[model samples]
Structure formats: C-alpha cells, structure tokens
Target: MSIAINLLPPEYRPRRHQLSRRVIIALVAGGLVLLAYVAFLGEMALAARRVAWLEGQLALYAPGAQQAAASNTALGDWRQKERELEQLVQNGRRWGQMLKTINEALPADAWLTGLEEDEGKGELTLTGGSTSLGGIGDFLTNLQGTNLWSMVSLQEVKGNGQSLTFTLRAVFPGAPGDAGKAGTIERAVEGK
Candidate 1:
C-alpha cells in the first residue's frame, strides 16, 4: 500500500492533479466548437476559389459568345433581304407576262381606260369601254381562255346606248416558263 504525505505549508502546497467533471466537459465542448468553425472556414475558402475559377472561364468565352450572337443577327437580316429581292423579281416577271397577255386578248372594239395591279394579292383590275356588248363579251371570253389569268370576274357593266363600260378583276398565277417572250417586250419597254 502506497502512502503520500505533504510536508509543505498550506500556502506552498501543490494543487490537486485531477480536473473537475464540469471543467473537463466544458473543455471538450469548446474543442468541438473550434473544430466546427475551422471546417466552416475551409468550406468558404473552397467555394470562393470555385467561384473565381468559373468567372475566369466565363470571361474567356464571352467574346466568342457575343460574336456568335452578332453573326446570327446578320444572317437573319441577310435572309430577310434575300426574300424581299426574290419577291420583287417574281412580281416584275409576273407583271411583264400579265401585260403582254392582256394586250393580246383585247378585242378590236374594246379599249382599256385604267389598269391596276396588286402584286401582294395577285390581283389585276381592268376598267374598259367597248363599242358594243358583243365586243365586251369577246374580250371577256378571250381573257378567260388565256393561261395567265384565273378567277376572271366581270364586276360591273354600264351601257350608254352604243357604248358599254365594264370593270373586270382577275387573278394572275405566277407561271414558270410563260415569261420568256414577255421578257423581251419588257426589256423593250424599259429601253434596255
């Protein structure tokens, strides 16, 4: 059996070697809290690094992204202009052929006073006067037989004794190969 004895005075005595239960528990809790705080700081640092890296990558590709957007806009504009040009060319060709067919189909005693074309609607309106009703009928028949005209309608007819005034509207189908000869006449009219 071991026996310990203290020979010093009370003021010089050594303190107890064992800690209290509450002090030990408090120390353990403080250590756990410190560890959690350190872990949180490590996570924050890693997140900051990741964010900076992503921003750098985005910066590298930003110019190419802008260029691609501009190129797409330019391509769209070019396509729109191309479509408009095609529409204009189609209208010009159709008008040339339509005028030629109308000139050929008119009767000798029928003369056109006003002619109007709506390219967008594919419509042609003709206002004319004829010496006789038979002449107007012959002109209508001739127009109906032509390949250039469709949905030919005589809207109005006014008779003043020996003279007859008529209004007619027709739809022109944009045919493919019928514009060959009419193209020459168009060029002649344009003095080209």
Candidate 2:
C-alpha cells in the first residue's frame, strides 16, 4: 500500500476523475453515428435484393408477354381472312342465282352461240341466233323486266333473211355502278 499526503490548501487540491462528462457524451455520439451507418448499409443491401427479385420476375414473364402479343396479331389476321372468304361465298351465291334466272328467261326459238361473263365488271355478253326477231325482242324484254339486269344494250344485229344473229351486253344489279348498285337484285328478290 502506498500512502500519499497532499500538503496544500483545500481549494488548490487536484481531483482525480476516470472520465469527463464531455468525453462520455462524445463517445456515445460517435457510437450512435457508427450504428446509423451500419443500418444504412443493411437497408441498401435489402433494397438491392428487392430490385434483383423484381428484375427476375420481369424476365420470367417476358416470353409469355411476347407470345400473347403474337397471338393477338394472328387472331386479327384470321378474322380478316374470314371476312374475305364470307364475301366471296356470298358473291358466288348471287352469280348462281343470276345464271338460273337468265336461263329461265331464254326464249324457246332462240339459241345461244356464245356467252361470256366478266365477274370483275359484272357484265355479260351473249351472241345468239333466232329464227324470229320477235323471239329476240321477247328475250330482251324478259331480261329487262327482271330486276337483276340493270342495263341491257343491243351491241350488234346482223344476219341474212333466213336467221338473225344478235349480240347483247347487259350489266347485272350487283355490278359496280355510280349508284352503288350492288345487292339491289338481292334485296328485290327477297322482297318478292
């Protein structure tokens, strides 16, 4: 044991301290700053993981998204083709009916030598010979009476006294016209 004796006035005596209050406060503050920095680093790591997870999810769905887009485009194309096919079928039906009507309207004395049809223009040209001119006139009148023939014109008439050769050109109702004449015959036929 060591014994130290201070021989001084009571006011001049030195006091021994382990740590000052200011130093304790500064240490506590420094520890708190370090702890905060560690927490910030942890939070940044968590955010990075979350971002990586989200990117993986997006990548997983990317192929499915592309397939869905391609499916939509193919569906649209199929629908367009279906519409076009339906139109073609409808046109075929109309032409068949028109041909039947023309056959029915033909006169017994008249025989057709040539018949040509232009589907794009909806025009029909017929070259026929008839022993009687009256039969040709009757055929023309019968065609005109039908709503299917929008316009009928006599193209040529040439023959000897024995028989007559005539060429006739006619436009059907569904033909393209200034009046938008398509489907007129269909409507008229349905009405009848």
Question: In terms of lDDT, which candidate is strongest?
Answer: 2
Report lDDT per candidate. Answer: 0.79, 0.79
Alpha-carbon error at 150 in model 1, in Å? 4.2
TM-score for each candidate, following the candidate numbering: 0.62, 0.49
Q: Candidate 2 lDDT, tens digit per residue, 51-102?
A: 9999999999999999999999999999999999998887754767777887
Which candidate comes out best when scored by TM-score?
1
Q: Total backbone clashes of model 2?
A: 0
- Tens digit of per-residue lDDT, candidate 1, span 1-37: 9999988998899877899899999999999999999
Please report the TM-score between candidate 2 and the true structure.
0.49
